[model samples]
Target chain A: MVHQYKLNGYHIVLDTCSGSVHAVDEVAYDIIGLYEEKTEEEITAQILEKYRGREDVTREEIRLCLADVAKLKQQGKLFTPDTYAPLANEFKERSGNVVKALCLHVAHTCNLNCAYCFASQGKYHGERALMSFETGKRALDFLIEHSGSRTNLEVDFFGGEPLMNWEVVKQLVLYARSVEKEHRKNFRFTLTTNGMLIDDDVIDFANREMSNVVLSLDGRKEVHDRLRVDYAGNGSFDRIVPKFQKLVAARGGKNYYMRGTFTHQNPDFTRDIDEMLRLGFTELSMEPVVCAPADPAALTQEDLTVVLKEYELLAQKMLDAKREGKEFTFYHYMIDLTKGPCIYKRISGCGSGTEYMAVTPWGDLYPCHQFVGEEKYKLGDIWNGISNHGAQEEFCACNAYTRKECEDCWAKLYCSGGCAANAYHAAGSVSGIYAAGCELFKKRMECAVMLQVADALPRQE
Target chain B: MKRIQTLETKNLCESAKKGGCGECQTSCQSACKTSCGIANQKCEKKDER
Candidate 1:
C-alpha cells in the first residue's frame, strides 16, 4: 500500500491506506520496494550488495533499515493488506440508478473559438444549436423524476456558451424553481460560460438564481488572447476582463471560479496564476489542457519537467500567501488524506454515466459533458430515459479496482482512476490510463504533500 | 469486516463538510463518492491519535 517516487532530490513514500507520508533515504526506499515481495533476510542481503563498495555501507546499517521496515509494518504504514476487492464487490452489488446531477448543454455554439476547445469551437463536431425551452424542461423533469430520495439536485447549464441561449436558460431556472417546492427538491443551478456575453442581466440573474458560475479566462491578456479568440480572430481578454470584474463585483466575488487552462505554451503556469491573483481573483482553478497530443498547444513529454517545476513554485507561492494571511484555495493543491479513500470515488470514477449525465442541446443524453458530441457514448434522450443502461453499467463498474494498471499503484487511492473522458481521448478506451494526465496528477499530489508539510513547519522567528 | 463496518457507519457528508471532499457541494454526492474511491470510514483512527 506504500507508493514511492523521487521529487526535489528526495524519495517520498506515501502509505495509501494510512495516509502517512515519509521522506526517506535511499536505503529505506530500497527496503520498502522489497518489503512486500522479499523476505527480510533477502532484503537485507540485497541491501548489503547494493552498498557493498561504499564506505558508508555496513551490516548494522542494513539491519537498521530492515528494523525500520518492521517498524513501518508494526505501525501499519507498510504491508497494509488490500481491501479494495471486498469494497468493489459490495459497490458492484449495490450499484443502482440514482441520477442526481445533470449537465444541460444549453447552447452548442460559442462565439469565441479557443484553439484547444474540445468541442471544436463549441459545435461538438456537430451542428450548432441551442437547447429549446421544451427540451430543457424535459431534461429538468427527467432529473427530478429519476433522482430518487436525493433532496439536493444539481443542474449545470453548459455550452459552447450557455449565455448564447439566455432566454431559455432563464426560463428553465424559473421553471425549475417552480417545480422544486412540489418535488421536495432543491435545484442547484450552475452556469459555465466563456464570460464574453456577460451583461448586467446575466450577472443579476446568475447572482440570484445560479448556485455558482465558472468563468473561463486563460490568465494574462497575452496568454489568454493567443488562444481564446472571437469570430473575427480577435483576442477575448480585453472584452471579457471588464465583464468578469463587473460580474465578480456584482456577486461580491463569491460562489464563482475564474477557471483557466494551461498548455505547453505556458509551462511556467504559475505566472498565469500570479497574474490572476494580481487581477484580484480569489477562487481560481487552472487546469491542464485536454487536447489531442498532435495539437501544437498540447502539453507534451518535453513540457512535463517545467510543468512539475511550475507546480512546485505555485505550491511555494501558496504557502507564502497563507503566511501573509492572503490565502486562496487552488483547486489542485486541495487534498485531504486524513480520511481513508472514498469508497464511492474508488468504485465510480467521475460519475460520467451513472449518477450524472449530460443532455445535449438536441435532447440527446451522454454520460458527461465531454461525451456530448461523440455519438458512440450517447446513452439516451429526454424522451427515453437511459436506453443505454449498459453504458451506465460500464461506467458504474469502472474504478481503480477494475483497472489492472491501478491495482498496485499507490496513487490509485488518491486519483481513484482518472477522468473517463480524458482516458478515452488519450487511449481510445474508457478504462485506459492517460499517461500524461496520470503523471501530472501524481506530480500535483506530490506538490500538495510537500505544501502540507511546509505549512506544518514552524515559521523561523 | 471491521473496515467494511467502519466504512458503512462513517458519514460521507460529514467528511465532505470538513472540506475533505473539495467539490462535494457542487457535485453529486453519489457520483463524487464513486469518483473519490476514498472509503467513507470513521475519520481515520490515526487522526484521532
Candidate 2:
C-alpha cells in the first residue's frame, strides 16, 4: 500500500509492504495516489485537470509519471504482497511457548516519588514490599523450565529501588549462576536503579556482576529536581549524579545507559541532552514522559510543535557530533533501516506478552514490566505456569496489520504499532495509538531518515 | 524541501526479514546481554553489520 504525506515542502511516498520511501514530484505523487482507484486514462485526465492551464503539463508528462509508478510496482516496491500473515501463523505455531526474558520486580516500592511515575511511586499502585529470595528463586526456575531450547535468558532486577532489596538481588544472582550449569542455561542480569542508594559496595557489586545497568537521572539538576524528588521533596540530582558518574567510570561507560525523561517543561530538550554529554555520558536516551494527560507536566497537544522542533535540533547536533568524531548514540536515533524490525515485529510488536514476561515481587507474572502492578494483566504466579493464555493470545494478536489506523500508516513498520502499555494507557486497548506518542515517533522517523541520508553523503573538504 | 532534497532515496528495511529472525534482534539481544549477561551471538553479529 502507498502512504503519502507532505513534509517540509517535499512529497514523501511510502510503500508500506516493501518499506520503500520516495521523494516524488507533485505529478508522480498524484499518480501514485490515483493508481489503484483509477484506470490509466482516468489518472491521466485527473493529472491534466490538476495542471490545467500549464503548457508544461501534458498527457505525455502524466504517462511518464504513470510509467514511474508502474516501474515501482514491477520492482515490488508498490502493491507488495503481505509476508507477515504467513510468518505470524508460523511464529504462533512454533515459537510462542518459549519464555526468553523476565523483568523481576525485586522491590515493589521506590524511594523517590517522581511526578510522572507510572508505577505510582514504585508500588505499582499496590502495597510497598520487596521480592523474597524464595519467590525470586521460583521465578528463575519457572523461566529455566519453560525456556525450551533457548540457552540464553534475561532477568532484570527492577523496583522502587532494587538496591532496597540488595541482599536478595545478590543472593539471586549467585543462585542463578549456580543453577546455570545444571540447567544448561546462562542467566544475564541487569539492574535498574534510581542511584539514591548507590554506595561504594553497591557500585562495586554492580560493576562486577550486572551485565548492564540503567541509571535514571532525568537531565540537568534543575529539570531533574523539579520532577524526580525524594520523599521529603528534595531533588535527587545532587545525590545521584556523583554515584552515576562513579558507576559509569567503573564500567568504563560500556553496557550501561543514562536514561532521562523529557516533559512539557523542557521544550528545548536538546539542552538537557547537551548537559548529559557535558556531564561525561556517552550512551544516552532522553525519552518523552508518558503519563496521564491530567498531570501538569505531561506533554499536551500544544507541546507537539516545540517537541518535534527540539528533536530536529537534536538530530542536527548528532550529525555535527558525528562529523567531529565525538559521536554518542541516542536510543531513538539508532534505527538500523536495513536490518530494522522484521515483518512479524511490525505486525505483532515486541513480543511482550509471549516471548518476554514480567514477574512481581510476590511471583505474580504479567506480560511485561509495564503491566507488572496491574492485577488484571497478571498471567499467573511462578508456582503455576501461565494461567491466562487468553490474555497472552490477545496481546499476541495485536499487530499493525490488525489495527485499522496502522494499516495505512507509512511509519507502521518503524513504530511496530507502538508500545502496548502506551496504547492501553491512552485508549484502553492494546491496538490503539497515543496521539502525542505517535507524533513523536513520526518526527523521530523523519529525523532518522535525514540523519541516515546525511551519513551516506560524501563529506566535502 | 531544501534540507532533505539531497537525501538519497532508499528503502528503510532493505534486508529486513531476508534471512534472519524477522525482528530487530538488537533489542532482545541487548536486553539479554545487558540485563542477564547472556548474549545471543547470532543477533550480535548481525547487529554489528
- Taking the tens digit of each residue's C-alpha lDDT, what string does model 2 give over A231-279? 8999999899999999899885458878888888886778889989999
TM-score of 1: 0.83
Residue lDDT tens for model 2, B1-49? 2112222333423434442342223243232211110011123224523
lDDT of 2 at A22: 66
Per-candidate local distance difference test = 0.73, 0.73
lDDT of 1 by residue, B1-49 (tens): 1000010112322322232221233232222211232332223233321
* TM-score of model number 1, chain B: 0.26
Using Cα atoms, each model's DockQ against the true complex is 0.12, 0.15
After TM-score superposition, what is the CA distance of residue A84 in candidate 1 from its true location, in Å? 0.9
Q: Which digits, one per residue and each the tens of the lDDT, describe model 1 over residues A1-461? A: 77777655456677665456666667778878898899878987898888789765577777776777677668656566665555654553454676778889999999998999888899989999999999999999998888776677889888889999999999999999999999998888888889988999999999999877888988888999999998889999988988988898889645777888888888788888988888888777788887888998888787888887888788778878998998986766665545443444444465668777889998998988778777878898888888887777778776667678877777776666777787788778888878777777777788777665455433422
Misplaced by over 4 Å in model 2 are A3-14, A21-72, A78-83, A459-461, B1-49
